[model samples]
Each structure stands twice: as structure tokens, then as C-alpha cells.
Target: MEKPQPVVVKVVTPEDREEAYRIRIEVFVTEQGYPEEGEIDHYDAVATHLILVFPTSDTPRRAYGTVRMVTLPDGTGKLGRLCVAAKLRGMGAGALLVRALEKEAKEMGLSAIVLSAQVHAKGFYEKLGYGFPDGGVEYMDDGAPHVKMAKTL
Candidate 1:
């Protein structure tokens, strides 16, 4: 039997926010070919950002995934920019990031959490309890197809 990797997800501190950005760019921009222009947006300034890290004795720590929650006008938390390193995709990193944000949203008294999930990743989000609302439609974001989904908290 093998031991599971130690994964820690935390609120990104002001100084460490850049680490989150780096992970986002590495996954979204560099690996997925998303234009760098719109990767970081105005919402990021006010949104609560989370960073998922893998800690090892060989080094202090390394950020492996990231996600953010932006409170919408309807008071629902909007989950966006979820990115986990390509190498760590199946290691449960993305789910950890989403769960961390869900915990934060619940603490903030949010009724639900919404997201525009990339079409291909829809099943991943679905397994986490997010679903498309009535009349939800596919939309384009950053040159990719996305559909809106929400999960009640």
C-alpha cells in the first residue's frame, strides 16, 4: 500500500497571491492556450482566492491548484478560474480547491455557489454537486465554451 500525498488548501495571503496567479497561468494560459490578456480580472481584487499546495521536506511548499469565489449581485458565490497543474489533475487537487472555496462561501453566509464551467470539465463539476439551472445556456469565455452551473449551500 502507498500513502496519499499531503495536500493543503488555504486562503492565499496578499503576498502569496502571485503564487496562485502563476499556477493559473501555467494551467490556463500556458497549458490550455488561453490568452494571458484576460486571465486576471477586476473581480480578482475583491474575490477570495484559494491556493492548493503540496508540502514536501525537500522544499517549503509548492502551489499546485487555485480557485476564487466572487460574491455576485444575487449574493451567490461565483466560482471561477479553477486550475490544477496538468501533472496533478487526477490526484484530487481540483476537488480540494473547490471544497475549500465552498467552506469559505458557507462561512460568508452564501446561499449558493455558481460557476461557468468549461464544457469539457462539466462532468467534473457535476460530480461535486454543481448543476445547470433551468434555461442555462452555453456561453463563450476566453474563447472557450462554458455553461453555467450552481450548487446550493
Candidate 2:
């Protein structure tokens, strides 16, 4: 199969809300078996910024992956709500989203970006130049172990 061209990344708007939510529902609720209610919470509206990916023109521009960015009072940025469609894993969608978020952060005058990466995915984030803040792991959401990683933009 032909590889997908580099995805065009953009800031999610009101029009993209449903697409983003649908992607999340597919990845988190259906594939990962997360409870629908728990997968989406209040933080979505108040503290999240979504990155929408249109990976190809031939196919519908579905929300293949999304990462939420939150700006702290000190002007730092936090990335959360990361999800990628199961069928599209190993295609660099998550990394592209992170890079896009970093660009957005730089534009926002933030010095760095942070994320609580699931332990299994730490290597993926590390390869993209993020370093773990704490030496050990943290079981933050449910029993999933995660490491807080960050990169200075």
C-alpha cells in the first residue's frame, strides 16, 4: 500500500469537535475498552486543546489522532488527551501531533511542553526528544503507569 503523505495538522475548531470526539470514542472507548463517561470528562472543555490530523486527501479527513494542550499560569504547556486510531498506529500520527503541538506552544510563547506518557509509550515519546521528569513511574489514571515527560521548545 502507498504510504500516507505527511499529515496536515491544524488547530481543532468547533466544527472539528465531533470528529475529534468520534476518534476518541473509537480509540479509547472501542479499542481500549475505556468507559465512555470516563474517557471524556470536564477537563476536555476547560483544559484541552485538540490537534486534528488530515493525513490524506483520498480518504475522509477523519481525526486520526489528537493531543490536548493546556497552558499553565507560569506559561508552561501541558499536553494531554492523546489518542490515535488503532488501525493507524505505528504510522507516526502521534509524533506528528506532538510536533504540531510544540509548534503551537512556541507560537504561544511557552518555553516547554509536558505530558504524562503511558509507560509503554515512553520510548515513543523519548525518541521524539522528551525526557522524563521523575526517575520512576506514576500510576496516574486508573492503574496505568505513566512517566511525566517534557521537552523545551
Candidate 3:
């Protein structure tokens, strides 16, 4: 079988922020049943890299996936609000975005990178070398269970 083409990942520009928001709305709000407010939280307007992924297409490109990274006060990088569009999930978009974010984190000299992986996706993050912390905290967001996972940069 022929391989699917790769999605291009990049740091979103101001002009692409709205497109990123729309992608998040589709994945987190509509598909996951999260409230509109919950899906677009305060951090979105603050310190973060709103990463956007676009597939090579003939027509106007669409936002395929996105994730936000924030530098904490202590210098640890946190990845959150990750979402891959439903139709594009198996095309490796999510993994590509994560790898791109890790590269950004390394350049920032972050001590570690952490994220709260949804329970169903813990194994996915595990495959990326992230693991649950010993005293890891768990919580539910919009009814989905999540636990903290971290990897040293």
C-alpha cells in the first residue's frame, strides 16, 4: 500500500490562530463533548505555541491537528489541548505534531516536558516515551479521565 503523505507542522502565526481554534473546536468541543468554554481556555491567549498542521492538498489547505505548549514558571514545558481532526487521525498527524513540539522544547532549554494524557491515549504517549509519574495526579476534564505524564528533554 502507498504511504500517506506527511503533514507539515509549524508554529502558528497570528493569522492562523483562528484556524487553530476551529480545529480544536471540532475535535475537543464537538467530537469529545466538551463545552465551548472548556475547549478554548484562558491559556490560549497567553504564553503558548499554537502549533498547526496542514496536509498537502490541491484545494485550500485545512487545519489537520494542533497542540499548545506552555513554558511553566519553573521552566518545564507543558503540552496540552492536543487534538487531531477525526478524519485525519490515523495519518500520523498527532505523532508528527508531538515530535515538532519536542524540538521546540529542546531549543527552549526546557528541563522536562509534561502533558496530561487522556486515559485512552496513555499508551499513545507511552509510545512517545512519556510515562506516568509516581505520585501522578489524575482528574477528569469534560468527563474524560486524564493523568500526568512527563519525559525529560
Clashing pairs in 1: none
Q: Residue by residue across 4-61, what tens digits does model 1's lDDT show?
A: 4646556546545888889889988898998898889999899898887755553434
User: What are the TM-scores, per candidate, against the unseen true structure?
Assistant: 0.89, 0.84, 0.85
Please identify model 3 stretches exceeding 4 Å from their true place: 1-4, 50-52, 55-61, 135-137
Predicted candidate 2 versus true structure: per-residue lDDT over 70-92, tens digit per residue? 78887889888788877668888
Best model per lDDT: 1
Superposed Cα deviation of residue 4, candidate 2 (Å): 5.3
lDDT for model 1, on a 0 to 1 scale? 0.84
Ranking by lDDT: 1, 3, 2
Position 120, candidate 1: lDDT: 95
Location of the lowest summed lDDT over 10 successive residues in candidate 3: 52-61
TM-score of 3: 0.85
